[model samples]
Target: MGAATTVAQNMSLCDKYTTALLKDNNATNQYTLMILLVNTAVIGNYTTTPAPKNAVPGILANGTFDGKAVNLLPYFDGSLLSSNRGGSSGVSVNFLDGGGAEPLKKNLPANDKNSHQYTLLTHLYEFFGVLLQCSEYNKNPAFPAYAGHDMESAHRFMDLSPSEVGYFIQQVGLSAASFGVSQEDVTAVGNSLNKLFGYRCSPPTVVVPEQGETLNSICQNEMCPLDEKARCDLYPNNGTVVEPARVNGTGNSTGNGTGMGMPNATASGTPGFSGAANRMGEGVISLLGALAFVVAL
Candidate 1:
């Protein structure tokens, strides 16, 4: 699609999204946080962020995607995140640097501090603007397009597993839905993001789930779910396989709602990593599978 057309489309979608949300009685809650975060952008704004591991934000539904260990709330210092900004909306992110205590901070420079974060939030504000198909984003080339990080590259070093990424994306939709975006609009937004994330799910290791391994996996298996296909992929089909004793527990026992309550579909609307001609080794692979499937899910 043409850039102009894409932006136009997104704007229309956001209009629908915002209009619906405005009509919702429960829209004032945290589910509106993401919408408020991005839609609040003016021509210039401060930005950068994440979801923390511990106390998962109540706005985000609990995720059960297979590999998710850490929640993705941006680091918070005491009351910063919880501080009631009330009804004022200007894009200013005051998230504190989590330092060594948070895993997402691993990729950031301790010295860079707020600078990098500011850039990130700026980009995200604009990216969502872009995601919303806001033409204002195109007003300047130096904005996100000129100086912004692609999702995977921006987050690759953050120690984010595919599931963590998936959780973040899943939450975006569910939260929006919780705030009252129509299911159709929510589904549309989710679909577009899934495609966006799939395209960006490259660099480092990009492995597609084979006919047997794929649980309708997209972005290779970057966010593959552990259902029949993933389960079979992780273990032998034979029931005789002996599982190892649980010596330690995984910190990723994150329990919220199921990840990607929405399914990430291929271009053909079939399950698994899209594409029709690429069948043979991939025959609509799994019965069903999902990862919050990011915008990266």
Candidate 2:
């Protein structure tokens, strides 16, 4: 689609998203966070500046599709990212600096504190993953020995498309798209957005009993029940009764809840290494995957 069309469509979608979020009491919370983050980008309020009261550092979700370990923070720390505050909306975007001079954060210098960063979308996904503790089973610190999960899988959950990206750019009032722009760049942005806030689900990795199965007898598999009605921590015959995890701080643990929780001591990652390495694989790819669009297109 042409730039104008893309912008119009995304603005419409954003409008729909906003209306639904405001009107619907049960909108998914993670998606709400995603929408807000996108809106923040559109309005030019980058998450953090080079100064004080910087946003808290969050854990990276998982490894990239290419198997690179990512230590992501919420803001563009100037090391991996270079920002331009000149879009039509005057919002700032943290673009990946491929030719950055400093290495990734390994005993770095002052100048290298926050360089070589992931794109804005990547930061959001990492924050979401950390917020939800997606790597752990049922948000229990006891599960998922690794700190990070598969980010690629999270991207699939987001299920972003090029059309969506087009809308997003327009909604945010981005620069005009010139000739020869490829679809992959937009697709990649959508992918990053998906990881950040998409809620698409694939088949269950664990084998919980079907709906007809007795909730009392379903604990042997170590998987939590997907059926909201079936997942009772107080059921008589099962092992330790666990409450379903809550999303978006609603105090209810069931399907469609936003599941936005705070990071705790349970989060994976070394003291200096950020959170555990994100292992979400190729399907999700890297949030910075769209950098090619910025660089080559």
Per-residue alpha-carbon lDDT of model 1 for 97-118, expressed as tens digits? 3232122223221334454334
Model 2: residue 25 alpha-carbon error in angstroms: 15
Against the true structure, candidate 2 has what lDDT?
0.25
- The lDDT values for all models are 0.30, 0.25
- The C-alpha TM-scores of every prediction are 0.40, 0.20
Model 1 score (lDDT): 0.30
C-alpha positional error of residue 225 in candidate 2 after TM-score superposition, expressed in Å: 41
Candidate 2: segments with Cα more than 4 A from true spot: 1-11, 24-35, 39-62, 72-75, 80-297
Model 1: residue 123 alpha-carbon error in angstroms? 1.5
Question: Residue 283 of candidate 2: its Cα lDDT?
Answer: 23
Error of 1 at 146 (Å): 7.0
